[model samples]
Target: MKEELLATFSNHFEKPLIDEIMEEGRLMEVPAGETIMDIGQYIRSMPLLLSGAIKVLREDEEGDELLLYYLEQGETCSVTMACCMGQTKSEIRAIAETDSRLVMVPVQKMEEWMAKYKGWRNYVFESYQNRLNELLQTVDSIAFKNLDQRLVDYLKKKVEVTNDNQIRNTHQEIAYDLHTSRVVVSRLLKKLEKMKKLELHRNYIQIVNL
Candidate 1:
């Protein structure tokens, strides 16, 4: 586990900090589609992704969800870090996008390490900046891009994160992520199919031109 931590995070964290993580962090496995954290929950630990992907989302009062960003291997959710630092409830939901392994670092250690380790502070700050940029990109897409174009971009990102051209998400699931009605998603997907950009199957969408 220590070796895994070092191999995945050594570039951003020092050996001593990694040693502490190995000692203090709890390793866990989360299956695909599992809700690891939900809105309004008090965050007790911060996750360090070891493998696979986790998608962070925000929900409206009506329960529609919007994809915020993905946490891939060697990445952590800055929103969760913020909740940890502030000792506040989570404002975003984190769901496993694929079967995943991660180390859950207790919230108490987060502050201790931030004050004790320069590398930890740098990692935290960089994560916040990266997440902010991603949020900006999402806002820009919603503000300027058409629904079809946003759907295409969303599909491309899913392919990149899973490293597969085939997306297993159902149309309704995709609708929820994009914060749209299933009918709208299906219509756009069909349009994309007719355009020869992708192929729609019973349970998955296969990327061709996209």
Candidate 2:
């Protein structure tokens, strides 16, 4: 765990802060498609990604969910941190995008470390700014971009984060993340295939021109 922490966060955090994390943080491994946190759940700890990716999601009052952003190695979710600091229930959901490793830091230590460590403070502020920008981008995409374009962009982002040309998510899963319908996703995917942008299969979609 110490080695993983050092490898993932050594550059971003001071040695003393790293030591504190080592002493207080609990290392965890999560499998792909696992829901680690969900709406209305009280957040007891903040997760620091050690390896792999996590997808942060937001749900509507109707219970429809949309992808907010992806958290990669060495990054943490700002929304989760906010809930932890505020001692409130989680408004967003966190799921493992791949087989993931993370360090769960107690909520109490989060505020304490902010006051004691410059690196921690910077990290927290930067995370908030980054997440805010991503949220704005999501809003823009929904408001301005056509569904076809948004679907392409979403596929590209998945490819980027996973570093895989073939997307393994089913049409229904894609619909859930995009907050659309499975029928719509299937239609758009077929259109993309006809346009030579991608190839649809029984389960996964393969990138061709995308």
Candidate 3:
């Protein structure tokens, strides 16, 4: 576990620092569909994703959630860093998009590392920049794009993230992600099928192109 964890963190950290962090961290596996962080949960640790994928979503006061972005291999949840730094509660949710393995770094080390470790500091800043850009893009998609275009983009993104053309989710699930109703998603999907953009199966969507 240490060896693989070390290898996973290598892109952002040196061996010595990785070893130190490993001493303070514990590697854990998250199952598919499991929630890693929930709204209002205390920020105890930040996870370093080693394998598989995670979907980060933001919830509104109405308890409605919209997909913010994805964090897969070689990525960390930046919002967790914010909560860790300020001793605040989590404002977003993280769910395992696939069975994923990650190392949980205690919140104490997070602050100290930012002040003390160059690698850690660089990682935090990079994560913040990356996630903010993703969120901005999400906003742009929602505000400027039509529902069909957004649905098309969403399918392409799911394929890119999961490396699977066959998206194993129901129309209701897709609607939830898109913040629409099942009937609307079903209608658009039929339109996409007529356009030969994709093929729909029971509880799944197979993208033929785009």
Candidate 4:
């Protein structure tokens, strides 16, 4: 983990900043399918993902979750920054999309770094910009696209993140992410299969194309 931290930090951060981070941060490994943060949870430590991916979800008033985006290697959580900066709570939930490793930095260090290091400030702003762009794209997709188109987009997104055309999510899981019913997801999957775009199985969908 020490070597991994050095490799990751060397890309953008200065040596002194990296050393302080290594000294102050704690390394944590999260298994696949684990929820790292939930709605309304207070932020204490900011996580810097070193490996694997995180699936970010926005929960509605009724507790239904809508997929927002994926945060992969070297991507920090923008929501974490918002909560840390404002002394607020998390509005979205973050789940490990794969077996993951993260370096958890105390909220104090996060704030100090932002003020003390130009690199840290730049990273924070870049993270916010990237997340905002992703959210805007998500809104556009939901507003202007049909359900089938959205489903295809979701599947393609998963493929892009995982680099695998085979998506190991059940229809119910897909529905939960897409904010639709399982029956609807199943019907659409069948339609997609018939169109020769994918093959549906018990738990996974294999993309034949796109």
**lDDT of each residue in 83-113, candidate 3, tens digit only:** 9888999998899988999989998888888
The residue-by-residue lDDT of candidate 2 on 4-116, one tens digit each, is 88888887899999999999999899999999899999999999999989999999989899999999989999999999999999999999988999999999999999999
Provide the global lDDT of candidate 1 against the true structure.
0.94
Give, for candidate 4, the lowest lDDT window spanning 10 residues: 5-14
Clashing pairs in 2: none
- Per-candidate TM equals 0.98, 0.97, 0.96, 0.96
Q: Write the per-residue lDDT of candidate 1 for residues 1-210, one digit (tens) a residue.
A: 888898899999999999999899999999999999999999999999999999999999988899998999999999999999899999999999999999999999999998999999999999999999999999999999999889999999999899999999999899999989999999999999999999999988999998
Q: Judged by lDDT relative to the true structure, which candidate is superior, 1 or 2?
A: 1
Order by TM-score, highest first: 1, 2, 3, 4
Q: Model 1 compared with the native: what TM-score?
A: 0.98
State residue 139's C-alpha deviation in candidate 1, in Å: 0.8
Q: Across residues 1-210, which tens digit of lDDT does each residue of candidate 4 receive?
A: 767877876776877898898899999899989999988899899899999989999989898889999998888999888898788989989999888999988999988998898888888899999999999999998999999999999999898877788899888899999999999999998999999999987767899986
Measured by lDDT, the strongest candidate is 1
Candidate 4 segments whose C-alpha is farther than 4 A from its true place: none
**lDDT accuracy of residue 91 in candidate 3:** 90
The number of residue pairs in model 4 that clash at the backbone is: 0
Clashing pairs in 4: none
RMSD each, Å: 0.8, 0.9, 1.1, 1.2
